[model samples]
Target chain A: MLKQYSFEKTAVQTFPDNVSLAMRTENLQVFYGANHAMHDADLGFPKNQITALIGASGSGKSTYLRSLNRMNDNIATVTGKIWYHGVDINEPNVNIYEIRRHIGMVFQRPNPFAKSIRENIVYALKANGIKGKAELEERVETSLKGAALWDEVKDSLDKSALALSGGQQQRLCIARSIAMEPDVLLLDEPCSALDPISTVKVEETLLELQKKYSIIIVTHNMQQAARVSSQCAFFHLGHVMEYTPTATMFSNPQIPVTQDYISGSFG
Target chain B: MEQTNFQLKKQDAQSHEWDARLHRATRATRKDWIGRGISYLCIGVIILVVASMLWFITSKGIATFTQNHVSLWKFLSGTNWAPDQGNIGALPMIVGSFAVTFAAAIVATPFAVGTAIFMTEISPNKGRKVLQPVIELLVGIPSVVYGFIGLAVVVPFMRHLVGGSGFGIISATFVLFVMVLPTITTMTVDSLRAVPRHYKEASLALGATRWQTVSRVILRSATPGILTAVIFGMARAFGEALAVQMVIGNAAIMPKNLISPASTLTSQLTTGIGDTIDGTLPNNALWSLALILLLMSLFFNALVRFIAKRGQLKNGR
Candidate 1:
């Protein structure tokens, strides 16, 4: 565990400084029992820019994302130091719920609660103790509009969220995440399960969200990485091989591994 | 000439091959029908057993309910239940069953739910393994043993304190509380555990406290399952015979106070086990009274089923 922690710590040190570093990790190592998932990984996510983490399956990219909000706490025996606004998130005093409120996550699968569409949007607000019917109604409308789903679901706000189409459910999840007005949004392969048109719509939503929230999206689609992200980081076997502007990373080719991955030689 | 000879032989061989293939298909079809027949036979057997049990209860107990004018209403609303006297009131017994079960539920629900939460969500890995086997063993202990313990220990203790006939609603209820606790506790835990992990994570991510998440998200989602568990416990409490009968003082009169000796429906049946009714009229009425009890139990069961059915539909939606 100690050795793996240092491995991630060294990896995080390799990134260059950017103007708006929303979240910074210094030597983050994650372990489940004896297996080391993420080696010394260091990276910085800039504000208002869509940063995409691209890697093959089992490359530790998702592990790094979950560690940001301490979602890994439930897994038992994970070691890492994640820094958000200069506070070490691993500190005993650091509340995980508060961290997650600021850094919301959208899962790969659309997991709408067994609740009405309006209630789904209002769940987070109610959890935060936001009441008053008028305020709740306004926030629900705004969040749905922000997610680009209001026009589609406005007439049936009272209908069950589970009754929505797959694409709509994923978008509803997005609305739920954004309703909290989080500082950073973490999306783990959000469009991997959707059809092509739905994928395009979700990508567009992510691009629009980049103006307000720092977005870290993990995608297997290189074209998507090229199209949506402002910056891209390529991870290989728990190591961050390259981090650069998406244009440069895709066209110019900084590292050999990144080039190999793009050319489809080996993941 | 060559074509004529070869074609004729080929046609003959082809007809034989087709005949063999058709024979094999018929055998396979017969096997499938036999398999389906066996499945249906098993189902039929189960349905038969259930129907026969209901039939037997109605046939035997129906006469007891239709015997006398006093027996019919008196069994449910009468102030006294005594076969020795011409009067056979069932109100005291009904009250006895309800009071004891209500108290038992009040005593056990919180403890059961609390234990369930600790076992499923809050307990450490090591503790979780210990919890299941312990609870399962608690459930396996026989009801007769429970009766003996209540008689030897609880009745004497109640006598010293609450006074009265020593064996009364207080002792019977205390024993029922212990008896019914495992049912609610186990089911509550199972239901809470059945809720998806996403719900918990969603609540946690929103900065809510652990207690808040459990109360708002976990418990609310698991309400139907927990309610079903409580309903099962209620059924068990009402039907419990030996343990409650042993502890409750066999007084046929309705108690004016909690300390007074009282009887339950089961107790009345046991106390009046085998005196031939004055005639078939009294016997039939007695059977009807028994049927009424059955109806009451069935009513509560249907209520639970209704709640459960609605919960299922909502979840499906």
Candidate 2:
């Protein structure tokens, strides 16, 4: 039997006035047709830090993450303010294509184009009107190194990406996204499909990436959140139930729903 | 008492049920046999029919060379085609077939790809609701109707533009273009739609514009399928007879220019078959033309299969 918990009593942490945020959402309500998926999810992500969104399936963690860069523009109706660089990017008139350039995204599945690894990394670069051969080669080397895939795939940069293992393909996807040099990177369960060894490698890569890019990840693994993220947000039934330091959320959850979820009593 | 009785029943059931044996044939089994028999019979009949047709055509086609003494090289390279005067050079019809087929495919490719892209990537709902039926209707329309329209409208238009009888290669090409456009466009749309949705999402998430995503990602990935569609369209154009015949004027002569009258392999076969006597050289030569058409279609099918296999390999499927 699942116990009913009160939705009104919640604990949401807020940052200090001096803390610079990479992005934030205010009164963010998402609707798929008439189904309200997310409601008033006001949260701030600190700059240059990893923030993990943890929840059960269909809890709107992915919906909220996708909306951070307006990836849900045509798929759903979002009525809220997504502030990035002090501009409300949720506005309809805003250029989403430009917004995506600054805030790249990685999907749960590694969708490497059916091209060579070099071509995969440089395709978006070429599309953005960069044509210098030496520059493209440089970016390819750096981005692949950044994603920690260069050492393994350096010899076969011309090889088809589909030839890579699941973990390698996921890293290549990360490399593809980061090749654009985005400010903030959003990952939607990026490591869920990976094995333990690959997961560790990806986690290590994420830790290394934190020094350069702000990271926001949605993960189902609580241990992963505690291991990687500095701050953690736990979502339940599309509501932001708890937001606190990763250690505190796992060690001492301030709410009943979060406590049960962490204990694996229910999700 | 009831428990003991149930245990005894279980023991009895287990002893016999656990033994390996087939059940008695029921009415359903009879019906199953009948259904299987019917399907196998249909397949057997079709295979026999096709094999016999191949045998008939090949035997009759080869009689021209073995019995009538026409050189294969001369027949292929000969510029003149007159069976009555013992000049059975079929180069004009061969060239005419290729010209109309190539011309139609070249003109139809851009329009087909554009329409396919519009249907798949741009306004897909409009494409499904409005354009899909229109394309299907075009496919359903009989070739005779299309040929009649060409004879009535396109021929006169060609006459006004080029100042000839308007029955020539150009007119036949226009007719074949209309006939093959739907075949190519529909297949192209299917191919474009077959591209995985994730490729588009990945491209868009990289901040690529819609046009950039479509041209660089979607169209590139669909290249094999699109090429197959073009080849299939060319095959259709190459084999179309009534439509080309209505506009080609059936001259059976060398096509001096695009505006001059000529005949395709199919056109000559259709019109000349009725004029020649049975077991004669003229009839056997016509059979040879049919053989060429058959070989060309088989080549097209082989090409499609090869591309599909290559595409599968590239995708690592």
Candidate 3:
């Protein structure tokens, strides 16, 4: 067996003073039973910018992203402090549901509820106690528009969301998340399942969304990170190996591992 | 000359091998045909048995109107059920069957659904491992045992609490409720488990509480499946003979109240068929009741199929 690298002692990079953070985590660790899946993942997501967490498979990028909103609570035991709005969300007493409302997520797959397009957008809004018909309709249109899907699906608002094409379904999922007006949106490989055209469309949507919400994304595609993200974190063996501006990270990676990974020598 | 002879001998061996391979292929084809024939024969036999049983019931049931000359409408709609006097109204038994089954469903639904939700969604993995098998064991228990329990426990309990004769609609309903609980719970758990984890995650990610996720997203998505379970449970309660017969007073009268004595079609058939002479009007009337039970179950089966198809359509399958 190979020697296990201890990532717990690795130093996390600090952001510049000019950057404003929307959310940050401190000493986050995840364990599935006895297996420590992630170790000491301290990362910061800047406000109104897209931050991409890129790594090879099993590098714990997705796990760290999921912990931001406590989505990992269902299956894994997460430890350490997720700092948001002067509160440690990882505390046992914290209301996970309330936190998740502000930190919405879009999954790797397009999992639109077996509902209509309109209902898909308004479901979270309604769950948050938005009952006005006019307001619900308005949010549906606005959210769909924001995801760049309204022009295609606005005419068929009542049709089942499942009937849409794969790319459209993914956009609908995006719209569904933004409908909640979450301050931060975490996307786990949102375009990894889509075709090239859909991928580009989603990348464009993420770029536009960065103006409104802080976005943290985990992507296996390095080019996607280069395209959409302002800040990029390269994870290796459950540690942030390098955190830098996306342009510099792509053009002149400071670490040899990040350089090797970006050059596709090994993943 | 020796080399040519050897080549000829090798060619002969290759041809022999080819012949053997062809023979084996033919034999395999023959085996496949035999297997297919057996499958078709088994299916045909099942169809034949069911068709014959249906034909027998239909012919015998119609004989009540033809040979005995009992008015068909009166036999169905009339309130009185006297074979010797030949009044023979089946309305009370039909009503009793429906009432008992409805009451059982009402009693069992919440409990079964709650248990199912606990098993699938709420319970931890270890708890699920234990609870699932126990509920399955409940299903394996025989109907007679359930009847005995109803007689020994529920009947007496009702006597003390509800001031009844301890054997009536109330007792029958309680017994059927327990009887159908396992089936409904198992099916509901399966349906709930069939819901994709992604749907729950999506709802939860939207900040919905666990209960809200289950009720709005999981249950709504699983509606068609849950409805199918309810229909299946109702069918079981409707067709159940021994348990309901033992707990229900088996009186030929209409159910006056929840505590009043009543009789279902199955109860009447089981209790009256043995005493009445075969080939009599009363026997044919009992056959008619069996026909009605068969029809009701068939209706329920059709309803299940209809709902399943609707679900498929909604899913765009």
> In terms of DockQ, which candidate is strongest?
3
Give the per-residue Cα lDDT of candidate 3 at B157. 92
Model 3 chain B weakest lDDT span, ten residues long: B119-128
Per-residue lDDT over B1-317 for candidate 2, one digit per residue giving the tens place of the 0 to 100 score: 99999999999888777563456667889999999999999999999999999999889888889999899998899988889888899999999999999999999999999999999898799999999999999999999999999999999999999988999999999999989999999999999999999999999999999999999999999999999999999999999999999999899899999997899999999899788998888988898888889889989999999999998898884
User: Each candidate: what lDDT?
Assistant: 0.80, 0.93, 0.90
Residue range with the least summed lDDT across 10 consecutive positions in model 1 chain B: B62-71
Ranked by lDDT, the better of candidates 1 and 3 is 3
Runs in model 3 deviating more than 4 A are A1-12, B1-25
Cα lDDT of model 2 by residue, A132-238, tens digit = 99999999999999999999999999999999999999999999989999999999999999999999999999999999999999999988999999999999888
Q: lDDT tens string, model 3, A1-267?
A: 323444443334688878779998988999989988887877888899999999889888999998899998868999988889878999989898899989999999999999999988888888889999999999999999999999998789999999998899999998998998999999999988999999999999999999999999999999899999999998887778788889989998877777778998763
Second chain of candidate 3: TM-score? 0.91
Candidate 2 residue pairs in backbone clash? none
For every candidate, C-alpha RMSD to the true structure in Å: 3.7, 3.4, 2.9
Residue A126 miss distance in model 3 (angstroms): 1.0
Q: Give residue B161's error in model 2 in angstroms.
A: 1.7
Candidate 2 segments exceeding 4 Å error:
A1-4, B1-20, B23-35
CAPRI grade of model 1: medium
